[model samples]
Structure formats: C-alpha cells, structure tokens
Target: MQSTASTPELYLAELPEERQHIMTALRDVIRENLPAGFEEVMSYGMLGYAVPHTLYPAGYHCDPKQPLPFMSIASQKRHIAVYHMGMYADEKLLDWFKEEYSKHSNTKLDMGKSCIRFKKPEQVPLALIGELASKMTPQEWVQVYESQIKR
Candidate 1:
C-alpha cells in the first residue's frame, strides 16, 4: 500500500476511478458529520478524518506525528471499510451498536477493534452511521483516553 502522508487530497485525486468514486462519497459524508478539529488525512493507505492536533498530538498507536483519529475509511483489495474507533474499542458502545445494527440489518458485519468492513457503500446506513460518528467528539474522546491510560 502506498502512503499519502503528505498531500492527501492530491493522493485521493489520483485513485482509480471506481475507488475514487466510493472514497469521495464516503469522504464527503464523513466530512459533513465530523466534529470540530477533525481534518481530512491519508493514513494507512486510505482516506481518513482526524483531529488536526489540538487534542491528540500523536495520532493512533501506529502513527504518532498526527492527531489520533476517531474514524477512518479505507479501500481494501475486495471492499471498503469505515472505521468507528470508539465503537469497537468500547465494549459497552460496541454491544449497544451491535443490537442497533441487528435491528436494521440481518447481515453480521466483520469488525476489528474499530473497523467495520462493508463490501459496498449501500450496505451502510448513512443515517445510523452519522449517529455513530456523532456519538463522541475530540474533547470527549481525549477525556476517555486519558482516563483509560491512567488505569
């Protein structure tokens, strides 16, 4: 996977037409709902939104130079994934969302700590996804992280 650590927008501009279409749509939807301080970024070879710097000086565990992200979108070899960091990392929240997810879709999506994989964008419920994205803000996220770190 190529890294677009610098010039993320330019990088996205160069993606394959099909991938670009999906990324653009996902990026726009995510951008529209993001909380303050979050900016567009290219991380892990995909388009992701993150806190610019105010809250997290060192982003995720893997990349410490940027602000840690709350969510992200990636184009995989076979599918795209929208990552909801808090949901998967937070047991209570994940369980709550699992119940909620089941109510609307019978399909059981594959999940990793915070990543939810979807074969296509249509499979994701935009409204519910928006709610999930809006559930926590950078400030609230930092507070949660700090408290957890203290443990």
Candidate 2:
C-alpha cells in the first residue's frame, strides 16, 4: 500500500522500536552512500530512495506520477525488508550480491527476486549494502531502468 506519509520522520515515527532501530542503522548506511542525484522520500508505506523528476522526468513506468524508485526499506510484520531494484534488472549484480552476501554474512540469505529480508541489523552486511548502493550514479541507474522498460 502506498504510504500517506509525506516525510521520512513520519515514516519512522510509525515503526515499532525494534524496527525503528534496524531501519535507523540501514538508513544511516543509505544516507552515507547514496549518490548525489538520488533523494530519500516516503513511498509505498516505506522509506524510498528515488530519482526525482528533475533527474528522470519520465518517472517510474508503473506510475509516472511518482518519482522513479531505486530502492526501499520497510519493517514488515515478520522481518525487515530491503527492496533493491538494481538486482531485478541486472543479473550480474544479483549474482555478485548473492556471492558477496554469502561471503560476508553468516546469516542465511533470505531473499526474493529483489527483496532481501533480515530480522536484525547485525544480520545485514553493511559493506555489501553500501557498495551496492554506491555502484551506480543516478544517470547509470536511469539507463538500466529504461533498458528494462524497453524490453
């Protein structure tokens, strides 16, 4: 469901304590490594990293009214979830991410096509997450996203 939240602070205020802590840590990592053109906003009832219209006016193909979503983090009922749009379109990145995750994290990788789930912040591979987030500039991500839309 799309969030009625218009700000990050509002999103954090609604999360439970444990979820707040986890999301806080992950948010720190994201804020630190997020590229220049990406902006953090609340979308789909979660924290979203997006390409503002100024950067990619076409917006997300699914909903042109919204900005293009690069990634999102949410506190699900069962676990913390990370949605990485990059891996969905890039097989090489997916393979590399999985291999790197296995090498770095002792916790079993619980992942969907693009969503990575973990219960605790300690289970996350901080370096891997940072590296992945910083892998592409806004322009590069737009190219990758557009390529998929074309096919």
Top candidate by TM-score: 2
Kindly provide the TM-score of model 1 when superposed on the true structure, using C-alpha atoms.
Answer: 0.81
Candidate 2 stretches with Cα past 4 Å from truth are 1-3
lDDT of each: 0.71, 0.86
The global Cα lDDT (0 to 1) of model 1 is: 0.71
Cα RMSD, each candidate: 2.5, 1.4
lDDT tens readout by residue for model 2, 13-73: 7787766776788888988898899999888888989999999999988899899999998
Cand. 2 TM to true fold: 0.93
TM-score of each: 0.81, 0.93
Residue 49 of model 2 has an lDDT of 96
